[model samples]
Target: MMGKTLVLVTGMVTLLSACTMMDQPKSLAFRHNAVTADPQAAGTAQVTTRPDGMVTTTLVLTGLTPGKTYAAHYHAFGPDSSTDPCASNGPVSVGFPSFTADASGRATTSVSSEMARIAGDLGAYINVHYADDLKVVPVCAPIKMTKG
Candidate 1:
């Protein structure tokens, strides 16, 4: 009767919604913490996965040393998997091209990697290190999946 018809339509709608979700790729974002004396020092990373396993990552940072080059990479740690100091985030999952901050203390770069993804065993962190020494990690942001 009327109630049975309503129930069947709801079930069909739910199934169709799930199918649409499966067809879409995943995306994630990470916000960097201020690790330097400049309280405004911060950064952000946006990660999106393609259907073919390639990952596109974009980084934007501010309040850094002007004209100073900085190295950045993807690390093997999600937001819940690491505990501080940035050293504990594990090894680099993917290395990106170095970028130098502009005179206004801003830098933006986009890179693609076949070994990086928003999910699975590829890890989920975007790490920025000191220009002079890659050993010094000044900004570390763990990627958190925002959409799929």
Candidate 2:
């Protein structure tokens, strides 16, 4: 009887430990918009989480004019998808460095953070600059990030 009781308790503990291990949270994926002034010069970004919690962002820029520099950042919300740009309700959990564009009109970057925190929500987009006007002429919005 004593041996049986010990076995049962051990089994229960092992089962509980397995359950806890399965409950560990995973990283998240992100959707981003590339904003530019040339209606043709914009696109989206897809961010995926790696096992080490670093995020790799794959950016696709279309309609680019070639040989132009763009001042970009991970903004908080999806463009008109939200009411304000600086508001806290959008997706950008943390801000990234300003990026430039190449002749083919594409650029990619990554971040090493959990990206799941409220500070890392980074909900929406990528903004590109036009060489002629030197102002942000395009805006992309409504990007999404989900647990992978």
Candidate 3:
């Protein structure tokens, strides 16, 4: 009976884990842009690479406009500069699902993509923006600090 119970519990745990397929190896901190449109926002983006050559980015945000829609994306290193990926004017490489903050002004979202899509310079940074107004970027999490 004990052995059977152990097997059953292990199976249940595996099933639960399968619901969330991503793994986080390290978390990257987000900083408000010097000329931020929403200075009140804060967050972190955790990037993890799986054995299958897939990447996952999980973002947790705070101090946003409660109940407002927001978008997040991984951006490629741009031509503006070589050292500062965040200020490089990079273009989007992968976009996460749009999400709305709760009443407390907090939100969490994640996106998964094949690693090749955002490898090296292509995954230079991630930024959070107002879904309705892309120009209003509140926070940025630099992945590759320098262009590769």
Candidate 4:
């Protein structure tokens, strides 16, 4: 009887642990295109909600111009409902600080904003433009939300 009770307790503990793991935040991936066929740059971003209700995002990217500063922002979905491609992503939802690539052409930055989590905001995107000219969007990525 004691052995059966122990097994049941262990199973219950395992189930509870799994439930907690499911509550953990998720990360999203973004890939940039030089044109429509060539992959230019890529980035990964994760959104975590703090206990204070502030949402924080950490973004890391590679394949940028060395020693160049770039402007990054979060944009809403475009008018087209079928797709949220980078080229048509709507107005800026959140503007992040400018990032300067290292000599190796890599950058990592963490910014805190009121932007919602992936589950909460499925129509948002991360856009990276030339720092000198915000009008030129060289590389951009749609924030694809996923679960663990």
Q: TM-score: which is higher, 1 or 2?
A: 1
- Where model 1 places Cα greater than 4 Å from the true spot, the runs are 1-39, 77-89, 115-118, 144-148
TM-score on alpha carbons, each prediction: 0.65, 0.48, 0.80, 0.70
- Which prediction has more favorable lDDT, 1 or 3? 3
lDDT per residue (tens digit) for residues 60-137 in model 3: 999898989999889999999899888898889999999999999999999999998888999999988899998888
**Tens-place lDDT digits, model 1, residues 1-148:** 9999999999999998876665364444334455543345577776655556666778878877788888888766534344442444556778789999899989988888774343533455677787678766667776532212
Which 10 successive residues of model 2 have the least lDDT summed? 25-34
Candidate 1 TM-score to native: 0.65
Residue 26 displacement (Å), model 2 = 15
Best by lDDT: 3
Model 4: per-residue Cα lDDT over 56-137, one tens digit each: 7777888778888888887765554435446554667777799898988888877776545322343367777778977767
**Of the candidates numbered 2 and 3, which has the greater lDDT value?**
3
- Number of the top candidate by TM-score? 3
Candidate ranking under lDDT, highest first, comes to: 3, 4, 1, 2
List clash counts for every candidate, in order.
Answer: 0, 18, 0, 0
Off by over 4 Å in 3: 1-24
Better of 2 and 4 by lDDT: 4
In order, the Cα lDDT scores of the candidates are: 0.66, 0.48, 0.87, 0.68
Give the per-residue lDDT digits (tens) of candidate 2, residues 1-148: 9999999999999998866654353332222224434555546555565556555554556555566655444555543434334322334454444455667766544444455542333544444334345344464433433311
Give all candidate RMSDs, comma-separated: 5.4, 7.7, 7.0, 4.6
Candidate 4: misplaced stretches above 4 Å? 1-25, 34-39, 115-123, 144-148
> lDDT of model 3 at residue 71?
90
